[model samples]
Target: MEQLQVKLGEKAQITTVMQEVFATEVGAVYQCNKRNRLVVDFANAQIVLKVDAFLRLKKAVDSIDLRDMAVNTQRCSDYELLTVCGCEKLYVLTLPEIYSFKELLGGAKFALELNSMLHECLHTQVA
Candidate 1:
């Protein structure tokens, strides 16, 4: 029917438009406002996460103690396991990789916050 065709057309038009937020040698982060999602491409994995989930992921990564990870002799300390509250994927990263991941997430968070501040400033009334 024509209604079905129209629905399909609308769905097609809802394409993801992504903007690069940050990048590093190990990974890159992108934001898609249309979907309100952050796409993190890291270590051969592409993770699509909601904005809140991305924040939680950043918090989790930031909580890791690099010094402890580096100094511990336990076999389990060889790799850090990270899991965000709402995200289903589990990330296992070695010390160096964890450091890179932390940097990537931190940079992305800063870029997104900066963009939000710019938008607010640009749109504010000149009162």
Candidate 2:
């Protein structure tokens, strides 16, 4: 995964993240007196999704517990497969290269931080 860049200002902060696997640009533009919005720029369209939508999605993903899940890691050809189960649904991810579990955990933590920041931005705007 590529690194996510966050810029904090006096009134608002911006987060810029790129999905290297796909043609997408996901960002959050936080400002005062307005709802914090999530901007998703695709190859052909620019979409502004409400931050609440992301919050809901984040809640669902955050509910997942790795401790209760079964993990199967294997290498097939040039890619690696990470299968996680034991939740309501099964998840299979194909990673182009091998990555440490710590790295994945760190990514999840970063996501949670991002969600918290977004939530706080919205709360500040509303208050």
Candidate 3:
């Protein structure tokens, strides 16, 4: 049940996000052609998640074409969340926007392979 809820707080722009979010990861985070979108790279999977809204981005998480993997979705007031398969614990990704999670990152171009890799690395660990 470990989830990272990044509230926009008082901020109103995308550029400011990199400063707050980048602190969590040293070099694994990257910004692309998109403004509010970001990529979290990990050993197992690279996660492409949009930081704008919770709902619209959730849809893109579903539309992401994946092979030989599992996906789960949940509905919340703030956002709709999704979790892809991991080596052990669930790999939880939350979209905290009020709109459909699909709308925010539909135009975003990234690798789903990165998504899976981020899921495995962030959510699982070897014992």
TM-score of model 3 (CA atoms): 0.23
* lDDT tens digits by residue: candidate 2, 1-127: 3433333334755545433212212223222223354432222223333545434433444444443333534333233223223112222322311222233333434655786799999999999
TM-score per candidate: 0.84, 0.27, 0.23
Better of 1 and 2 by lDDT: 1
Candidate 2: segments with Cα more than 4 A from true spot: 1-36, 40-48, 71-127
Best model number under TM-score:
1
Q: Which residue window of length 10 is worst by lDDT in model 3?
A: 18-27
User: Model 3 misses residue 46 by how many Å?
Assistant: 0.6
Q: Report lDDT (CA) for all predictions.
A: 0.81, 0.37, 0.38
Task: Candidate 1: give the clashing pairs.
Answer: none
**Per-model C-alpha RMSD:** 7.2, 12.2, 15.2
Candidate 2 global TM-score:
0.27
lDDT at 17, model 2: 48
- Pairing residues by index, what is the TM-score of model 1? 0.84
**Each candidate's clash count:** 0, 0, 25
